[model samples]
Target: MRNARFEGKVAVITGGSGGIGAAVARRLASEGAAVAIGYRGNKDAADALVDELAANGGRAIAVQADAADAEQTQALIDRVVTEFGRLDVLVSCAGIEHFDALENITPDDFDRVFAVNTRGQLFAVQHAAAHMGAGGRIVLTSSVSASKAFFGHTLYAASKAAVEAMVLNLSAELGEKGITINAIAPGGTATAMAVEYGAGYLHPELAGKTSLSDWLKTQVALKRLAEPSEVAAGYAFLASDDAAYMTGRTLQYDGGMF
Candidate 1:
């Protein structure tokens, strides 16, 4: 494959301010794509990333938009088209995970998780589809929790499960347009969110017992957490022309964590 696989393309990545999203943005931009970083609140981080990309001879812009809001989501696509004059790739990486057991889950929490993880992804693809032509690639971020029964992830898993289903239906609907829609389901990754969720981290209370991180590692064949860049590489592949024949499938980059 060419080093500049994304050259002359334009990509919009939601939640590009940090974590897997930021890693994807950086990888795409480095490969010569004009990237628009969609951020909800952290303008500083977004601006800093844009500047860093520019400094490294990459074309990038930072846009402020909340993925949970339908209007803002549409506006995000519009802003990217206005700035870059086209949209070739859309990566819906904006998501929030609120872990609550079934008995403790709230209605608001359910709505919040679906608002960004599920609804946001749908609208992002719907609007981006309008601007994309042949060869457009859409990548959605999902999680292993979508299929695996994880503790305190009822709401989060449900939202991602919806995304996985949507990818299949949308692939059939959009295939004629030559647009490929797929998803990446990552396992325990070394991101700030992972730390907050007790992945690959030491907890004092669980010191004597089996820690969450230890238990998770043992479950994975790799026996380790995946790095953000490792997950981003999956996004890069799906967004590239090399993955043209693959669609409607959720690629699991979960360190063999089924």
Candidate 2:
């Protein structure tokens, strides 16, 4: 049976058009939350997911909201509240990856990654907190690169590390509001974004050993990359009552990478 942990709750998933975000949407909606898919672009994808969820008897909608912009992030939360008359969970899965060597990194690279991955989540939670009464949950997405060493993750890793900082540092602050903030660090999820940018993180030695698709499995004890749904399960836990006492920490779901 689908859990009713989120019954009568409202959620806005920024980057809901993407792989991980879409999976999170499906997970939350299945658990009985009314979901609004806030996407910067790709209306087609977002709309399709909303339709699928609705057809399955879930309440869902697709909306345009740019996560990188604080004002827009604020708008998304407010819009969901207006549409559903309540706000409860915020799962920020909107982030970009930029991998480059020390010499090849650019200032723009730093700006874009942090803008969406860090600054965006800060404001989203900031806005969402203002509306949630109590028992509100915030789940920000981090990456394995933030906690461990990964080749060419100079920019991307730093961006996510900032997110980790927020999760750790803001717990006390959010606790005052009867809310909890946490994060999830997914290792290597089999998402389109992963396949698209995974190669850019390759150092010469790893690239020389094998193709990205094959080499990735060797790094994980599970011998495979995680499905986006697996990562979504992590998000669901943080957003549900089960994690009510859990905060100021990150759930690392990286397929036992060492």
Question: Could you say which candidate leads in lDDT?
Answer: 1
lDDT string for model 2 (189-212, tens) is: 889987887776556677766777
| TM-score against native, each model | 0.95, 0.96
Q: Show model 1 residue runs off by greater than 4 Å.
A: 199-208
**lDDT of every predicted structure (CA atoms):** 0.91, 0.89
- Whole-model lDDT for model 2 versus the true structure? 0.89
Q: TM-score of predicted model 2?
A: 0.96
- Per-residue lDDT over 54-165 for candidate 1, one digit per residue giving the tens place of the 0 to 100 score: 9989999999999999899899999999999999999989998776668998888888889999999999999999999999999998888888886667789899999999
Worst 10 residues of 2 by lDDT: 200-209
Q: What 10-residue stretch in candidate 1 is worst by lDDT?
A: 198-207
Clashing pairs in 2: none
